[model samples]
Target chain A: MGEGMIQDQSDEDLMKAVAKANQSAFRTLVNRHMGRANTIAMRSLPRREDAEEAVQDSFCKIWVNAASFDPDKAKFMTWFVRILTNTCLDKIRSNPPRAGDIDALADVLADDAASYDAQYGQKREGEAIRKAVQTLPDRQRMAVILCYFEEMTNPQAAEVLGINVKALEGLLVRARRDLKGRLGAGEDNDG
Target chain B: MTDDDLKKRLRAWTVPAPDSGLADRIVMNALRHPQKMPWSLRLGKTLETWLLDWNAGAIYKCASLAMIVVIGLSIGYSSPYAGGADTISIVDLAMGGMNEWEGS
Candidate 1:
């Protein structure tokens, strides 16, 4: 199909084309979702190499399992996020992030003391929040990532996690508490 | 910091852009190594690959030996022709000497 023609199709149509080894469809899908995938991976893994590997592995899985996608079960982003999240989680499980690694990453992200970055304080807070998030138990981290960072609704996030909505809410509650305890934040919004 | 402040910071913190070639790289890698269908079959294939080093031939040999031992015992103890000297011995069955019984 022509590039313009392929661009006119929806994600589900693109995925079906991908199942048939349509490289153009696959490229379109990659272009469509790569940024979100990169953000999820970069946030979760916090290291360039691991995050890159996770995203690559996820897209690879998506390519292979395109045919298995049941639209009734999940939208394309949900399914894709689930894969990316699982890949990041696997990376997390295998290579438990060290404290020094987090600090080093924060320093790297901090970058350039001389660059009059007005959001320096905000950036620092972001790093601290990420650090606190890192300290969370794996499931709690996932809950925060999906519900908060990815901005998924409770049911949608739960669907991706393969957990019930109630359980997912429970995770979020506990996660908020954990983050509160660790960061001295989340007071008014503790619910 | 206020809760909203933290939330705003969370929203604002975007990781720097990764390499421009990433999407292309991912697509190429995926095309090169397409996923297999039906997880169960893939799992079975993976298990087969992993367990290939366990010497399955030895297992088959052991199973054959067990069957031979069972047949030997059944035939020796449960012979139907107990009184006839012309009845084939267990040795005849073992050594393919049952042709003599056919002649008789």
Candidate 2:
């Protein structure tokens, strides 16, 4: 199929073509989802390099395991998110974040600072939110990242986390509560 | 903060966009490493995970080892006598095929 034609196919269909080792279909899928995958990885991981590696590894896995994917069980993005999230979690476990490591989110803020000089207050608020997020327990951090940052639904986030919806809700509630307390304290200190 | 406010604040922590070359790099990496895992290996991983979950990993390993030993022994014993004919007669070789060796 032509590149444009391949691009038009759904992710699930593209996966089928990928199962046959069709490079065009695989490339299309990669181009379509790489940014989202990177964002998810960046949120979960502390370092930019690690996040990039995790995204690469996750896509490689998708290519390798395309034949095993069952669209009936879940949408392609859902399956992909499960793989991406697990990859990130495994990376986190092996090399737990160090206190002094430069965070990828900070880099984002710094880049924003240069481009949007007028949004100084927003930049600081963003920094505070990032710090508060990093302080959350791993699962809770992930819950907030997926639901709030990525905008996944409760069921979708729960599926990615391998928990029931109720459990996922509990995580989000506790996570938000913790963030409220931390961010509020930051504000109080600033004032 | 209210839930809506918290959500809004969370959005402020935007991730940096992925680098322009990321897709090309990932595609190139996949091309270079053309081989993905075979289904058998994936199935093995799934089985291993299941076994570990139930804390039966040690038992699974022992069972696998025992099976290997049993299969090896069975194959060794079965192949030697499978033809039902003596390929090498030790007594004949010793006697040099002499039925009556009435030596001096």
Which segments of candidate 2 are over 4 A away from where they belong? A102-117, B34-104
**Tens-digit lDDT string for candidate 1 (A1-191):** 89999999999999888878889999999888888888888878856899999999999998888878877877998899999888999999899887687788778757843265666656666777778787788888888888888889999999898899999989888877777666665433443
Candidate 2 docking quality: incorrect, acceptable, medium or high: acceptable
Predictions in order: lDDT: 0.80, 0.85
Instruction: Give candidate 2's whole-model lDDT.
Output: 0.85
Off by over 4 Å in 1: A185-191, B1-6, B39-104
TM values, all candidates: 0.72, 0.74
Please write out the lDDT profile of model 2 over residues B1-104, one tens digit for every residue: 89999899789877779999999889888766654656786789788887677665768777988999999888867885554536465555657746557453
Give the per-residue lDDT of model 2 (tens digit) for A1-191: 89889989999999989988899999999999998999888878878899999999998888878878889999999999999999988999999988855454566566767667667677777778878988788899899989998899999999989999999999999999999999989989999
Q: TM-score of model 1 relative to the true fold?
A: 0.72
Error of 1 at A169 (Å): 0.9
lDDT of 1 by residue, B18-72 (tens): 7899987898788888566777766786678656855656676678889999998
DockQ of all predictions against the true structure, Cα-based: 0.35, 0.35
The positional error of residue A162 in candidate 1, measured at the CA in angstroms, is 0.4
Question: Model 2, B6: alpha-carbon shift in Å?
Answer: 0.5
